[model samples]
Target chain A: MDMIWQGIHDAFSLTIQRDPAIVKAAILTLQVSLSAVLLATAIGLPLGAIVGNKNFWGRNIIVIFFRTGMGIPTVFVGLICFAMFSRQGPLGQFQLLYSPQAIAIGEFLLALPIIFSMTQGAVSSLDRRVADTAQALGAGPIRKLVTLISEARIGVVLGIFTALARCLTELGIAVMVGGNIANRTRTLATATALETSRGEFARGIAMGIILLSMSLSFTLFLAILTRKKNSEVTR
Target chain B: MIDINQLHVSKAGKSICHVHRFHLDVGHRCWISGPNGSGKSTLLRVLANLEQPTSGSCRITAPAIDIVYLEQSPFLFKGGLRHNLSFGLKCRKVSRDVRLKRVEETIESFRLQSFLNQDLRTISGGECQRIALARALILEPQLLLLDEPFAELDLEYVELVNEIMSCRPTMTVLMTSPHRPPESWSFDHLTMAKHTP
Candidate 1:
């Protein structure tokens, strides 16, 4: 209990004093996670819309592939990225190994399947009349897409929130691909793991507290959003 | 401005609707009456290009004619009444000022001003129908297909809709209903044959 209280005290103090190492890790965590999520949303939204709504020759296959990808191990993704970005690998000339970009690439891959699958599910569950009405209203492809997205906004938001959560808490990808470089590639998850391994229990606990707080904030926001959505539907 | 010949719509190899011959002149109104399993809605949907015939073809003479269809239980996207009214216009790329002007006029005509700012999902079915009709009308569609649009409305709203339809001389309307439309409303009647098991 004393150690836990001491850890909580140190967390606030570190946060207030802006400890450079802790602050850098925290900032990098935000940077990598946000970038991954933004890219995932940008790519996943349209792709999900198309896959979810259209019936094409290979649509089922695509859906199956993405659904399978949802469960892909992050370490494998990290391994593949590391293999490609390593000094002697095919993409080695770019020298992306052990860098923030490499970490972002891994996170992006991790978040993409989640965003796509959830968005696809959301878009797929919409009433068929929504698209039919849009078509009858003379909506072009882009307009129809926008209308569909708006109608399924709750689902899309939930998808994004889930992706954000996945990216924020990811440890394997951050450690393996980011290499947990101090003040450069270290994320909160990776920092926590590193500190705990070095027997620095207080610092590790503090990092855990920060991560838990961030996730809790997101969970609360999602709960409110879901309540609003339910009320809208019921009304 | 539509033609259907030997039109047969089927689901899973089971024929749901069959129309031997049908034609509509420009500005004409078509009221289709049938029993529950007679495919009145399906026929209207096919006309509106919402469904495709299994083996036959339907051709619209005026391909450039803007078309809109309102289902019995109309779908209103997540937004205020005003937003739903302006959706079709926005899709057509109408200017914002023109959209607002047209929306205001529609609200006044439909007497929907009270619910203009309210969420559409919160409104009654009759109000939703009125909003759907108004939304479709604002597009100035040349062909308007309605599927049992008056099934849930009160007599007053039905009369208001009829009046609105009567005023649009250039628009061709197609509607389906279980009962015959009011005598005051002129329409070329088509009866769908009930599907055999």
Candidate 2:
């Protein structure tokens, strides 16, 4: 209890004082996680919409594959990225390992399936009449898809938030692929792990506090956005 | 113009609805009348190309973009009356000025001007029917398929809809109803009975 209180006090002080180490780690965390989430959303939303809205051979299999991927361990993602970015590997020529880019790549792998599966669920749960209505209104295939997605926008945004949360707090990928280099590749998650392992509880708690704050901020933003949309719909 | 030759629709190997030798000229209005479970809605859906016939053909002379279908309970997309009314025109990528002009005209014609700023969910069923009709008509579709357009409407609303529809002399309309339309409608009738086998 005493240690926790001390840590909380230290955290506020560090935050107010604008400690360079904590600030750098936080910025890097945001950079890597946001980039990963953006990439995941870009690829996942359309793919999920296609999978959810259309009937084709092996669609069920593809959905199950992505659903399974949502549960893949982050450490395993880190390992796979490590191999691809290591010397003598197929993609090793770019020399991306132990860098922020490598961490983002690992986080991207971690986030993609989550966004894809959630988006698929969202799109699939929509009323069947939505497509028919769009079609009846003379919308082409692409336009019809846009209409369906817009109707399901709330769910899509939720999927994006979930992916961002996952990417933001994950430690295995950040530690392994990012190498947690001070001021360069370190993220909140990696920094927290390092500080705690080194018996620096206050520092670890500070990083944890920042991480929690970020997640809370994102969730609040999502709530406000959805609330405004719902009010518009009902008002 | 529309033509159907021996149209049959089924579900789970059970015959639902079948029509033989039906034809309607461009700019004509037809009412499909039947009892409940007689597949009046299914036939309209088949004509709308929303459902495939089990073993027949429906040929519409209008281009796909010029054909529109409304279900029994018309769906209003999330938004106010104006958004729902102008959705079709937006889909067609009409200019904002043109869209606004057409939407305003539709609102006036449907007497939906008062409801334009209200939440769509608060509107009555008859009002929803009008909005759905207005949305479809804004596109000026050559072929309009309406499944029970008057199902939820009151007598006054029915007359209002009839009056509005009467103005579109060049648009083809095919609507389904559980009973014969009002004597004032002047629609050619096609009666459907439930398939026994």
Candidate 3:
């Protein structure tokens, strides 16, 4: 217990001092996660809307695939990206392996299913009158889609929030594809792992604290938003 | 003005409704009443273009006539009561001043001023229904299609709605009901088992 307190104390001190290495890793973590989450959202939201709003051939099969993808292991995704981007692999001429782009790609893959599945669930559960009302009010197709999406805005935001959480916290993809290089690809997750392995407890704990606090803040925000939404819906 | 010719609708290969011939002049009111599952809503849906006819066609004489359909259970989207009230007007791109003025008038007329800023989900079922009607009326629809608009409403509201319908002399109204409306309002009767003009 004394050791834990000491570590926590030292962690805050290092974090407040803005230690160069820790800052670098923290920035890289945000950059990579933001990039990946943005890409995932850009791809996931439209696909979700399509699946949620329309009936087409093999839609159930596609939904099944996405639902299954949501449970896919991060390390598996990292492994797949590594294999695709490795020097000996086909289409490896771009040599993206072990780069920030590679890390972002892996993270994007990990977050996509989460965003897609949640968005699909949200849009699918919208009230039937969302479409009917929009149509009766003289809304064109694009306007109707906008209205429907706006009505389901809470669920969509939750989906994006879940994707951000997944991208920011997952270590398997970041470490495996980012290569954990000293200054270049060292995200917070990778840095924490390396520092802990080297017995640099203070630095590791500091990074962990940051990650934990960010995650907690996000969950609290979601809780508040969800509560407000429920009250509004139930009222 | 509207015209129908041998319109038919089906669900899962089962015939739902078949309307042989029907016509309505501008400013006319038609009341459709029938037993449950008699496709009264189906015929209204066909006229509202909410449902596709399995065969035949419905023709609107006015090329640019606006239409609004109100469902049995009033639907208020997730928003403030004012937002729900102004939704149809917003869709028509009504100006901000007009929207505000119209919303204000509607609130006063329907005695919904207290619910102006309240969340729609917080309102009673009857209140929501009134809001739905107010929203539709704000658009000044040339054609109004209502599905059992009086199901859960109070007598005061029922009379209020009838008064509004009567006041709109040029707006054609087609409504579905389980029974004929009160004796005060006169409407052309179109029964579904056999659509008699």
Instruction: State the lDDT of candidate 2 residue by residue for A137-174, as single tens digits.
Output: 88888888778788899888888998899999998888
Docking verdict class for candidate 1: acceptable
Segments in model 3 whose C-alpha atoms lie over 4 Å from true places: A87-95, A223-235, B62-65, B182-184, B194-197
Among all windows of ten consecutive residues in candidate 2 chain A, which has the lowest summed lDDT?
A226-235
lDDT of 3 by residue, A1-235 (tens): 9878888999999989999998888888888888998999888888887788888999999899988998888899988988888888774898888889999989899888888888888889998878887787777677777777778787888888878888887888877778899889898888898899999888899999988877888889888987786565433
Scanning candidate 1 chain B in windows of ten residues, the lowest lDDT window is B56-65
Tens digits of lDDT, candidate 2, B1-197:
99999998899988899898899999898998887888888887777777889998889899887899998898899877778877888877889999988888888887887775678877888788888888887788889898988888878877877777788898999998876887878889998888886
> Could you tell me which residue pairs clash in candidate 2?
none
Model 3 chain B is weakest, by summed lDDT over 10 consecutive residues, at: B188-197
Error of 3 at A191 (Å): 0.9
- State candidate 1's TM-score: 0.92
Interface RMSD of each: 4.1, 2.1, 3.7
Using DockQ as the measure, the top candidate is 2
Candidate 3 backbone collisions, by pair? A235-B121, A235-B122
TM-score of chain B of each: 0.95, 0.93, 0.93
Give the DockQ-based CAPRI class for model 2.
Answer: medium
Q: What TM-score results for chain B when candidate 2 is compared with the true chain B?
A: 0.93
Query: In angstroms, how far off is A108's CA in candidate 2?
Result: 1.4
